[model samples]
Target: MKGRSILLDHVGEREAAALMVDGKLEDLLIDDDSQPRPGAIFRAICDRPLKGQGGMMLRLPEGETAFLRQSKGLRPGQPMLVQVTGYTEAGKAVPVTDRVLFKSRYAIVTPGKPGVNVSRSIDDEEDRARISAIGHAVMEGIEHGLILRSSCAGADDDDIAEDIAAMADLASAVLNDLEGTEPEALTEGDGPHVLAWREWVSAAEVVTDEGCFEDHGVMDQIEALKSPFIDLGEGHMYVEATRALVAVDVNTGGDTSPAAALKANLAASRMLPRALRLRGLGGQLAVDFAPISKAHRKQVEQSLRASFRNDAIETSLVGWTTMGLFELQRKRERLPLAAILRGL
Candidate 1:
């Protein structure tokens, strides 16, 4: 991809960041830059607690139960470390383990759970092995996981080790400050578009213009969520997102031939994911493709996965339901664009 630009509009009551890929607006990030983001470690007091299969649901002093796998030993009124994961659809708190993980340009240092993990982006087998070994060596005796980022591919292990050590000292300083501070954010995650910009357009120009949406082409890139139909050249897609799930239907626009219909369905399989991501839609999503033979199902699934491969968030393409709709789930971070824009 060519170099892009970022526009940050913060003049309004809410702040929004727009990412332009190759001079075209691609993603919108709505976040309050004045406040701290998620990933901050906090000393939270537990309220109510319940154990679930996946994790424990413990209400914290911040007024939301944290979804954590290691909440087994936590009890009510106890001060424990917690990290803000993100927000839910209803603006509820979602907290994770207090394990402070700091992401540098080259690596991620996890100071809470000591271990070694390599990023999935590094595909080379030998490189993966070498980075993992280096992580293990550097993280020895530390209660944290050292993740070798893809940027560390050609990096020297000694340099990476030094970076890890430096980050360890930073984490220690933050922890030491917790001795006096109450429940509050110690660090913040980057804005959604900021992360997207770093991963997709590293050298992109950044500008802040509160009036750029109507003046520039920023509005063109955002998905008009209220409009259910999305034009896809060969065909158009009708998308409906309820509180429970998101449903999308593919239909041929003008040409009704079987070949044309198949082409449209294939196009929908590829385009829908991008549309959803642009709209920042997440949670359960189901796509109803134009009818195709059972033999073609595998091909459609492959196309869908390939289309979603570029997304930063984790997306799982679950198999078709009994009614033939394809099921998938995307990890939700913040509210969708529609809600944020409409002040919902």
Candidate 2:
């Protein structure tokens, strides 16, 4: 696979990074860690006792109350390792977990769960078995469990093993250091742009524009993500995010031919994932492609799947809805791009 150039533009409160693929904004990343989001692991001190789900909360060292799982028995002043699992909205306590997840390029090393597992996205049985065997062999005596990523599909066994071993060392070091460290984040999982391009792109391919994000066309692209409609010359896509799911609608105005509709929908399908990543839209997503005949729907679906296949984030096509909407889901580990910008 060919690599894409990366541009980091730091202009406003939140810095934006654009992955330039084929001269287009393929992926967008924003630095908006003003508050914790999902997958953020923090070493927190419990300031109060946690009760049932009605109003259970734990005060962190930062003088903020975080949502505590009702089932866990926690007391005041108890130091605990908590990972944010989900955050529904801004200014609200996020759902958290005690399980600490350490992610690497090719695997996620999780403590307490010992064994090797393949990513569910890798559907090839042979590849899964091969990666699993390699994972288990490399992680045999380690206390942490390993999850082989899809990127490791065709990787050499030795390379995979080495990466796993390195992650194990990092995990052990992190766990050991948690004893005396102040309340702080330990590590961060790779986002789509970083995970997809960092290793593949050269130093020259990665460029940074400090305080010039708005000058180099990056601001325009970032602004596009905030709008509900994205014009694509031949067609336009409408993006709507509700509390429940992210919905996308593809429309081809003034063109009614089957081929024209297919072309427009295909373009929209390719653009949708990039928009989703740029906007940090995740959870359940439904894309309603322009009405196409049953014979051509499969082609559009395949194209959409292909578009998402290259994404660093794991995504799955869950078939079409009864109403002819294309259904899919993407992994949500951080605040949406829009939310991050909103925080700024």
lDDT of 1 by residue, 1-344 (tens): 25677777642466677777776657667774322356656666665555455455545434445666565676766666667665565654464765657766566777656677888988999988988887777667777667777777877788777777777666766766644323455555676555644455355677765577655666555545558788888889987789899888898878878787678878898787667766767889998888878888888888888888876778899988888889999877556667666762
- Against the reference, the lDDT scores of all candidates come to 0.69, 0.72
Find the 10 residues in a row with the least total lDDT in model 2: 195-204
In candidate 2, what are the lDDT values of residues 211-237, reduced to their tens digit? 445554667777777788888777888
Report lDDT (Cα) of residue 329, candidate 2: 80
Best by TM-score: 1
TM-scores, all candidates, are 0.79, 0.69
lDDT for position 240 in model 1: 76
Candidate 1 residue pairs in clash (backbone atoms < 3 Å): 113-144, 114-143, 114-144, 115-144
